[model samples]
Target: MSRVPFYLLVGVLLVAGIAVTIYRHVAFEVPWVPGEQRQVWEVEAQVNFIAEGESAKVNLALPSNQEGFRILTENTGSSGFGLSFLDDDKGRRAQWATREAKGSQQLYYSVQLLVAPNAAQPRVEPPPPDQDVSWARPYDTAAKEVIDQAYRRSSDAFTFSRELARAFSGDRQDENARLLLTQFDRPTLLVKLLNQAGVSARKIHGLLLEDGRRRQSLTTWIQVFDADNDWVIINPTSGEQGRPDNLLLWEAGDQAALEVQGGRDSKVTFSMLQHNEPASVAVRNQLANDTLLNFSIHSLPLEEQSLFKTILLIPIGALVVVLLRVLIGIKTSGTFMPVLIALAFIQTTLFTGLAGFLLVVAVGLVIRNYLSYLNLLLVARVSAVIITVIAIISIFSVVAYRMGLNAGLTITFFPMIILSWTIERMSILWEEEGPKEVLIQGGGSLLTAVLAYLAMNNPWIRHITFNFLGVQLILMAFILLLGNYTGYRLLELRRFKPITED
Candidate 1:
């Protein structure tokens, strides 16, 4: 067949594939009306009551800031004695009693409150009395040095806050936050620890939202105001307990409350079922009905909604591989080798998986090259190379296991035939055009593989491929455009530069 006809046929097939994918993913009927708005406030309570048989008053404090929420109505079950809502000077209160049960009886209630637009204050228990008594700050010279290194690297409030939070938490949880903390001072860690122990603390961000210009970036530490000590400014992230004038307090709370919103609206519904059966059995039964409410795109603008729908374009990656091979004269061992490799990289991550793949390929190539000295026929030579590649992979797995490289398992996904064919091509080039030519071609193939891996594994690409059906149409258009490019490639242009000069 003529190269033109072959290219045309491949282009037609690619256009068809893109069309189907777009129809499957991108095309969606978004309503003219705005998206729905949903706000969820998850409240969990753990109550402990200590009684010595006398009718003692039990007081539970509610959040003081009553700006946005209102207790609409409350329903009481038969298990509790008397319930009363008390209004306190600082915050709201709810009072209830229990009839003397010999052992311990627990009561649970969920209060449904209307959510307001503004922020809500998180409720926190008062700190122990000993918290006010300042003891000599504990000494840890190593930790102090680490903190200094962190501060020197980062001066941003977010960085300082993250570091301070990490140091205070003793680097137990919050891996992302810990990464941020490793750049600051010991005082930051101590302050973060104090905040975690029920003291109000935070790293505040200051910016000129109105002016659109750079504003003063200051890190001020402020303690929460209590009955004894007024709000004290302490630089915890700085490793200094005493106040620093550079720190600014935007707002103070026991703990930070984060509220995420989007331009488009969304809502989530939750239902709970309780049975008299054993807790474990009930949990098992509930697992069957468990549904996850994913609200990722609820807040995006309408113009961006179409972008969110392009997730169906994953199959286009296959078309891209095919086009690269037939139209662009790229040589891959197997028909679907590049696509399969790309998909594998998607699962294993590009950098780590590509490194493992290259390592395996290198080892396989070495073995194949050594075996070439045996002077076997083409089929036998290819087969022997495959076996050698497999054996090399097995050894790699063993070594990886001993060294604790978990990524070693990805070697199984390496196409044996592809490796064998690559070795054969490289050997042919080595004999004909020399090692330089072989290396150049090998480098080109590896570069294309890396590009394919990156394009296929991109988050935006995945999102478009999985979400929207119309993206396939866009892909079809791209394929059609690339199909008409009859001009020489950038490499071909260089090769024909002498002729062009004439």
Candidate 2:
């Protein structure tokens, strides 16, 4: 191919890629590939109760400002009932009250949240004093002893609270800890001890975010205010200090999460599910509450989108193969054969795919060498090799399956005809150019495949290729430009060492 035509082609494709990328980003407002999808969660707090003929008042706790998340909007699924936010015993409560009510009622208060990067923590108020905490009989002495030990052994508020929590569970605990554990739950007792130590702390309730969960109860944990005004929360049972990454801080204070009046068998439950939303939708919603995801791939059927996700990365594999062969002087079996092999490796994984490919090719080569004695024609010999390669793969898969290796079954998708042809060529190369050249070419091919696999498997590379279709055209332009190189490759430079020395 003339270098001029190749250069012109590359220039054309490069322009096309850039132009399309600009159009998508400017006119359609598709986000840059990295910020394409936001981790958005839909969390619901549900209240169920039986209402008598008397007036009914149902109060439920609601989530406020939390870290690393921007609250989008909340839902109040209430019909024919009064809804209001009141400062009850709980810090903030969503009260649904009605007069002359009867029968069953289920209410949901849901919030949509988008996770943001490097989000700042919300400001927390100073904890209240431990009011009327005069313990009964021996419990009073136990509380004092626990607090004194924790404060003396620790240097700071966070450490002091952790020490006080640890004293209740482990064998190193004293009689004070045993007495406290028997008197109150671990979370409640931990806060009481921290308060006695003059550290401002409280017992807060939240739910560990588990997807598709229902009828979940609130879990209690210890939250202490340090000197610098940051909230230091800890798991009371394990003494592991820190808020859990996925916990939803629902409410604080001594009040229950849900309270019911003039009713029997009242209960509250929580349900939460998470979803990955494209930034296009977030942008649209931020613009004017547009429901459309705005011309993103998420608009496609999920099955088709998944297929496209894999198919789009093939160009990345091809680009890797081209760079290795053209610039680095790697001798692959066929021009793009290693690309296909590497693509398959993305599915079966590197170790399994390499082991399977070698096993199939090796057995086929041995079988073909034996058949060479029959003086077969070229067409018949190729056909025979293809069939033999398939049969060997089948038997190997069966044995691997019987042995409980599920990864082996994925090898069924390996291009059997290509491997057959590779073995045939390597066999011919072995006789004509010797085993040294055969080994060199085969090793080079395997190395290229491995490099290509690594490139294609990168999460950032996969994201860019699948989300931004223009990147594939840019990749094609890159491969085209690399194809026109006329100088010696990196490996070929070593072959001319004496000339360089002169």
Best by lDDT: 2
Compute each candidate's TM-score over C-alphas. 0.39, 0.52
Q: Which candidate leads in TM-score? A: 2
For each candidate, the alpha-carbon lDDT, in order, equals: 0.47, 0.80
Reference-based TM-score, model 1: 0.39
Model 2 scores what on Cα lDDT? 0.80
Model 1: ten consecutive residues of lowest lDDT: 259-268
lDDT of 2 by residue, 97-131 (tens): 88867888888898886655444576677766576
Root-mean-square deviation (CA) per prediction:
22.8, 14.5
